[model samples]
Structure formats: structure tokens, C-alpha cells
Target: MDGPFATAFSLIASGDPALMQIIGLSLRVTLTAVLIACAVGLPLGAALALARFPGRGAVIVVFNALMGLPPVVAGLIVYLMLSRSGPLGSLALLFTPTAMIIAQTLLILPIVISLTRSVVEDLWAEYREQLLSLGAGRLRAVPTLLWDGRVSLLTGVLAGFGRASAEVGAVLIVGGNIAGHTRTMTTAITLETARGQLGLAVALGIILLTLTLTLNAVAWGAGQWARGRLG
Candidate 1:
């Protein structure tokens, strides 16, 4: 434990308030984005899974392709949308936490939607027989299928959180990485690295990884408990 590693440990042990504030803001933005994405994606994906309409395949393909959308591009799009000349410019959401959240939400929305679509679609096929036999329409089956497949769906949710938490490009552009305001863990790491504060950057990275790991573990455990209870 020397060099940056030593400094990182010291930083963690010191419980720096600035570090804690950054971590808290990061969680707030990422969690809020993930929640919003799930709220929209889960039901939409499930609907897509059950609904058979014209060009549905194309729509799915579009979403699947969007999963690979570059973060910088997402940030650029958000920036343009929120810029003073753009349609939503009147809201003045640019360079703010809300803007950061919007950017991250766009980044991870595809992941949640695509993954949920896949999981729900598979579950739908297997349950089609019983559900139809029970006179359950596609719309009616959505809730039941979602409930039974909740554990699997948690993977998509976690994936969204992971992506949102790790991405810096989108948030940086829309957030402006403003100190004590829109700055997040990812942006902070970028800032520290740019400032040549390697030790601080490494410490921030470790803290971020720990936070992500802890959240993932808790979510996984909760999913496991739900699965057990459902069984």
C-alpha cells in the first residue's frame, strides 16, 4: 500500500465530506434514472413481448440496437435538446442534476427495455398455453407474467443501474461536472484524472466500485429472497 493505493486508503479512512457528498449525489442521480427507466421500460417491454402488431420486429430491433448506443452520443443529444435553442430549452434543464439524470436515463433506458423485452418474451411463450387456457388476455397476462418473472427482470434493472453509475460521458456533458452541484462519481473521477490527482482518482474509483458492488449484492439478495418466496 504505497503511492496511490496508500492515498486511496487514507482518503477512505478519513471519511471526507466532499467524497461522501459526491457519492450521495451519484446514487441519487443514478437511482432516480434507473427507477424512471424501469417505470417506463418494464411495462412497455412487456407490452411489446405480448403484442403482435405491424413493424413490432423493427421496433424491437431498434431498441436492441440502441442498447449499443455510445454514451457520448447520448450526452450530445441531451445537450442539444436542452440547449437554449432547442425545443425543451425553455425548461433550462441543461448543466444540472436533472439534465444528468436525463442523459443517464437515455443511456440505460435501452438496456432495461431490451433486456426486459427478452426476459418477458421468453416467459410469455412458456405461459401462453396456461394463461390462454385460463382465459387470460395478453394485457391481463402482463401483470402475472411480470410478477412470476420478477427475479429475472431484476437482472435488467441491475444492468441499468450499473450502466448509469459507470457512465461519465453523458453526465459530464449535460451536468457540466459542476462542483458541489451536478458532479457525480464518474465525472469526479474524470475531473481528478484531468487534474493529475491520480491518488484521489484511484480512491474515487474504489469507492464507486464498492458502492456499485454493494448495491448489486443487495439487489441480488433481494431477488433471491423473492424467488424463494415465490417458490
Candidate 2:
């Protein structure tokens, strides 16, 4: 046990090429998924929170529920949808990086939407009275309100990215852990650990944790700076 642990530390210090590749791939997939989630989720969440419509509460409830969905369940759904004979099977995207990205996007979209809604909902409440008192049209008020709540909206994006980057189950199931192809840090770590390659696994694990930490720290600092500028 001690020997393998020591080897793991040593391998991590060596900075292996395979390790680098996995790390890079993980970042690419996570970033792509987060970007897609933001593009689709931000406006939808704002609409859900700000627009007056029938069944709006139900939509909010459904999104909130999906925000808590288990990763394995999401993975299974992706697997079925992309596997042979499945509805989307003709695309032939299973076991590919694109498939992993799609799965992760699905997993994180609900999170982004729910968090964005929460943030925007608060802003809507705070500004409703003031905007109405001034007789400002809802359309004119929306842009200003969204800008004022930029920090919170950014927080929601960060939350979604963080969640997507750290997720493993869905990515693993859909990506097949193919080396130099679909392999990501999370999948690599699992494969290495399963094969008793503890050294490589630990090294990858350390890198993964470090990357996640660095990204989140940068996001937090940026949010703080934005808040300061707003102030």
C-alpha cells in the first residue's frame, strides 16, 4: 500500500504525456458543455423567472427537481438515447467526445437554469416596485435589472461549470474511456485505479483536483471584482 502511494506521488511529479492529454481533454469537454449550458440556460431561466405566464410555477418546479438528479441516471439516459437502435443512434456519436459533452450539458443545464432563476427572481422582486412606480415598461426594465444582477448570474454560470467539470459518471458511461480519444481526466483516473495503476490514478486525481480548484478560485475572484466595480 505504501509503495503504491509513493509511486503515485512520484508519477504525478513526472508530468506524464498521457496525464496531460487527459487533463486537456477534460477541460475541453467541460468548457464546451458549460458554454452550451450558458447559451441555452441563461435566457430560459431569465424568461422563466421574469415572464408572466400560466404554468410558470410548474416549469420552475421541474427545473428545480432536475437540478438534484443523480449523475448515474443521467448517464443511463444518455446511453440509451445514443446507443444502437436508440432514437439518436443514427448520429453515431456514442463513445465520442461530443457524446460526453452532450451528456454533461444535459446534466448541468438544470443547475444553471435553477440557479439563474433564483438570482433573477430576487432581482425581479427588488426592482418590481421601483420600476412600476416609475412607470418603466417591463421591456426597458429587464436589461437594467439583468445588468444590476450580473454578479448573481455569473455565480450561476460558475456553479454550472464547476458541477459539469467535476462530474464523472455520465462522462464515463457515454465516453467509453477511449485512450487518446474520449479519455478525460475523470475517466482516466477511474480506468487507472481499476487496473491497479495507483500511481497514475493518484497523479491524475491530483491534477483534476488542482484544475477544478484553480478554475473556481479564478471565477470567485472575478465575481468579487465585478461586485466591487458595481459598488
Which predicted model would earn the best lDDT?
1
* Clash totals, every prediction: 0, 1
Tens-place lDDT per residue, model 1, 15-39, is 8888778989999999999999999
The numbered model that scores best in TM-score is 1
Tens digit of per-residue lDDT, candidate 2, span 180-231: 9999888887888899987767767776777888988998898899888877
User: Which residue pairs show backbone clashes in model 2?
Assistant: 8-199
- Give me the overall lDDT of model 2: 0.84
Residue 118 of model 2, lDDT score: 85
Worst 10 residues of 2 by lDDT: 1-10
